[model samples]
Target: MEWLDERKMDRGKKPGKLLGNKNSKNHMDLQDIIRESALPFLPAKSLRRFTGVCREWKLQISTPFFAHNQSYSFRDVSGFFCQSPSGALSFVSLNQMAYGVPDPSLKFLPEPVDIRCSSNGLLCCQGRTGYRAYYICNPVTQKWKKLPETTANHGTDPAVVLVFEPSLLNFVAEYKLVVSFASDLDGYEFEIYSSIDGSWRISAEISFGKMKLLPRTGVHVNGVVYWSSSMGRIFSFDLSCERSTIINNIGSSSLGAVNGKLHTACLLGSKLSVSELSNAYTNTMQMNSSAKQWQVKHAVTLNFSVPDLYPRSYDKETVLFLGGDVVVIRHEKKLISYNMKTKEFTEVITEEDTYSRMVPYVNSLVEI
Candidate 1:
């Protein structure tokens, strides 16, 4: 018993010392506390503050027993703030499209102006530094690699850029990286990159004059990137054979062609669908895969559409939706969310709307 409490005094001569008895009991209690805290499942919730308790506490917290609790499964940043499949919104960068998602969480990539959603959350991103010269980025984890600047160098230039992933289950899905660069000014050069060797190869020239600036949101399907140009041309690039071809002109000059940015979401059942914004205010468009192209499938009305033609629907500062849709829409100070399958839109919340002079802005919503 004395061995268990080192602070115990030799009480043979000093009968019963109250102070010594208290000290001995306190020493045994310290040992009991240490033993109880060593259990694996027991974790210190306030490990940071517990570390400042004393040097001993810090050492214990740093140990494997305590440190394990510090790890969080997911933390999303800037982009759309939405919960992951597991419902953990720890850290995420939802700001600058796919380019802004930081390291450890995603691949370091250049600023991509346009991005296409691929199978299993993978993205084909076209990021450029100067006029028409661009690199490619993947949004699955933000991995990126720069594509060759010159495909032909024939004084032609690429009017638009796109990246496509063809397969869903396998990494090497018959598809590859393709870009439409230097079409005329740079020499109508079509370039392709292989996932196996990481090389860029040029395809046979599809001679054409300066390409009409069309909607750059190119959708990838059946191993090709499809886009409708302002000059009224439907372009297709084959990833497997590394080829470029022109398809029949689709859509119409009569219908209001949204000059801003177009988004395409492909469906699986039968046809293709896309999300297009036409004459709508404060509504971030979600296009389905059933129309001639991706036409508006879901619409959320705004209190003020006004003249903000260049509508910044995705605000980097706010996490709109994380892995999935976080909001349906925001009117003035109120925010909303929607279900992708039910085709139903609902208001999630209402805020002060200070940024737009009380005008209201809900860029993107993702769980962080």
Candidate 2:
């Protein structure tokens, strides 16, 4: 009778154990399905809230794999980060007035700094606390880290560009920062900082012959930093190879990256001409020692008359940014964008005050 009772209890426990295992497996499957389906569609700002749902969600969102996958949805020009003369920060979305999406309320930066460049959702701000103070931050996350002082001495303000690419590597995520400037001796110099190696080093080709980097005109595309020069040249420094090469010959031009290609904006006999730099450095297998010029795919002339404020004809208006066919410029007291296709100019007003400097901004969840 005792043996019969033991067998009965064992039989009852086996069915319960099997049922529990099946339910646990189904729950894990559901979790994986949810993680895979929702992660791609969610905007970067939503990632923080979803991370708190569970420990699994927290681990998945924090992984570099998730960051890389989510980056694909970030290329759209969501908004513009505007900083006025008074050092007040405001973000204006392109679809703000139309779509009614609430403006992102990011934490204020500790100090006022000119947002110099942005790459892969990280912005590089040039602080006013002397020339050495620079901050790299994700504006959406409002997390910032100050950069190390540059090793090379720059007489003028350096053209700083940050290059960040999210990857699956958890340890020592690599970030490349290039600072191109005219050296004290009146020649071009490139000082680079690497997050993986954790130090700043000047480029191997230190003294670029007779070419000085133009102040406040630097743009990065596809892991290379390009700056217009004083000697009618557009030179590029490849962050991976740490080599410098001249790509175009645009004399004292303002440069911007549009559609992943370099565009030069220069005064073409009183009208601002937009020229796309195409087919510049394709042949890397067999090198051509001759100085290669960037082929202008097409050019568009803008109705940019000389503002009455500036008296000289040679006084070129600064091109703030170039987005697709639209060119944003500061003329007199107005911030306007000239459409290349339509040849129409529209005023871009943020609040009542005119924005001094404008750079293309895209919000993201990049951790500091």
Q: Give a tens-digit lDDT track for model 2, residues 204-295.
A: 66554775566546778777788766566677887778778876556545676667777876554446766776667555635765634464
What TM-score goes with each of the models? 0.39, 0.65
lDDT of each: 0.37, 0.65
**Candidate 1 structure quality by residue, lDDT tens digits, 1-368:** 77745545555435567768989999988865763344222222223444686677677656642322222111211232222333222122222232132332222554533332222223333433464344433332244455555444422223333332222233232335555654544335566666565666777756465554333334454445555455555555555665555543323211111222333332222222335432222223356533243345534433334233121222211212212322223334444333455545455333223231111111211111
> Once superposed on the true structure, which residue ranges of model 1 sit more than 4 Å away at CA?
1-150, 153-175, 184-187, 209-211, 238-340, 346-368
Minimum summed lDDT over a 10-residue window in model 2 is located at 308-317
Name the regions of candidate 2 deviating beyond 4 angstroms.
1-68, 97-112, 168-173, 209-212, 250-254, 258-260, 265-274, 279-318, 323-347, 352-355
The TM-score obtained by model 1 is 0.39
Q: What RMSD value applies to candidate 1?
A: 15.4
Query: Which candidate number would show the highest TM-score if scored against the true structure?
Result: 2
